[model samples]
Target: MAATKKARQPAELEMIGGKSKRQRIWEVIRAQRDGLTCYALSRRSGVDDCTTKTYMQALERGGFIEQSNETVRIGDEKQYRLIKDNGLEAPRLTKDGQPVTQGRSQEQMWRTMRILGSDFNYQELAGLASTSEVTVSPAAARDYLKHLAHAGYVTVVAKGKGRGAGGVPNRYRFNLGRYTGPRPPMVQRTKSIYDPNVGKVVWQEEVSDDDL
Candidate 1:
């Protein structure tokens, strides 16, 4: 596992720009008002037809898309229409049409930050960001805030003291001038942060001699 840490797979490399196959397929579908068949999605989206069909199933069940009566007569080709147009970011879902909960915490935190204003601590961020369906921990919230501060989207207003009843958690404020868009900046597996709002990687971890 340690040896594989620095070694990136081809798939991971492809996702560096945040354009995954599912997202590509979703973009195509959203643009096509008349809808597209699974085969057509494969040809245009660069995703294989079978895999597109699988993704289509989940999207359709999730109410993001609906199947049209039109058929292309190639394989099990049937036209699929996009229903929920939630801007650029593709909806994350499982094969069973369930929401992929892995990334929800970031979304919650980002949304809360916008509504929360300034002088908020990581503990407060976590508490407000968490919903009945999802929970956000102080540690995760602190880490995310650190990246945001590094990226200039957030500012460190005050530093926290040591852990205790007397300890005060770090306070932060969202940089109104740095606000990009609705999408949250994501911390990638490579220790970089990508801002989907600006459609670019905003921050990356510096490489050290030890890593080489």
Candidate 2:
């Protein structure tokens, strides 16, 4: 009997622009119309979970990708999508050409400040941050507020006695005018999934962890 030849599998996608691992990941995300969870993306891109997460954080800080508020059922991983088309490229930079990054606590504080308006105390801000799924302690919130105040992003509006006698807490307001930094990109609520058979994206769904 003649020997049979085995079929060869297709080669994996190559990275473009001699880009770094993170950049390659971003390219993969850019190609997908539907957002992907960290796990799904890692599996498809052949990147490990830890590296994927690190790059994801960097991309998020650069306003290249936005993390959905929802989580996947398999591992509670958050979905990520490229920021909507605004002519701005990924790896967003600050005015001084610095990479824009924010810690989770700082992000929560900033978001709370923006949503709750300029008039709020650290306690209120902390509560709002917690409700928004970013847990922040009151002390930590106060520290973040102080840092913002020093950076001119926030201003002390008032001071009041704390819950305990002789204790004082400062009320701060967001200085929107002074803030000229890059803001988080607006995200779409739903995305379209590509169907290989049809050669086009045919289905749209609310960004969630549920099976498609």
TM-score of each: 0.79, 0.41
Instruction: Estimate, for each residue in 1-212, the C-alpha lDDT of model 2 and write its tens digit.
Output: 99999653211112223233454565568778356677877877777788677777766666666777564577476877777533423453443334654345665666667766658888888888875445778887876676556445678899767566467788888887754433311111233322222223233444556754
Off by over 4 Å in 1: 1-20, 33-35, 48-51, 70-76, 82-89, 164-166
* Residue pairs with backbone atoms closer than 3 Å in model 2 (clashes): none
**How well is each residue in 1-212 modelled by candidate 1, as lDDT tens digits?**
45655564333344524577888888888888455778888899888887788998998889888877654565565776777887877788999877899879999999899887567999899999999999999899989999999888889899888887788888999888888887788887878887765667788889999999
Give the root-mean-square deviation of each candidate in angstroms. 4.1, 20.3
Candidate 2 has an lDDT of 0.59
**Which 10 consecutive residues of model 2 have the lowest summed lDDT?**
184-193
* Among all candidates shown, the one with the greatest lDDT: 1
Best by TM-score: 1
Task: Report, for every candidate in turn, its global Cα lDDT versus the true structure.
Answer: 0.82, 0.59
RMSD from true fold, candidate 1: 4.1
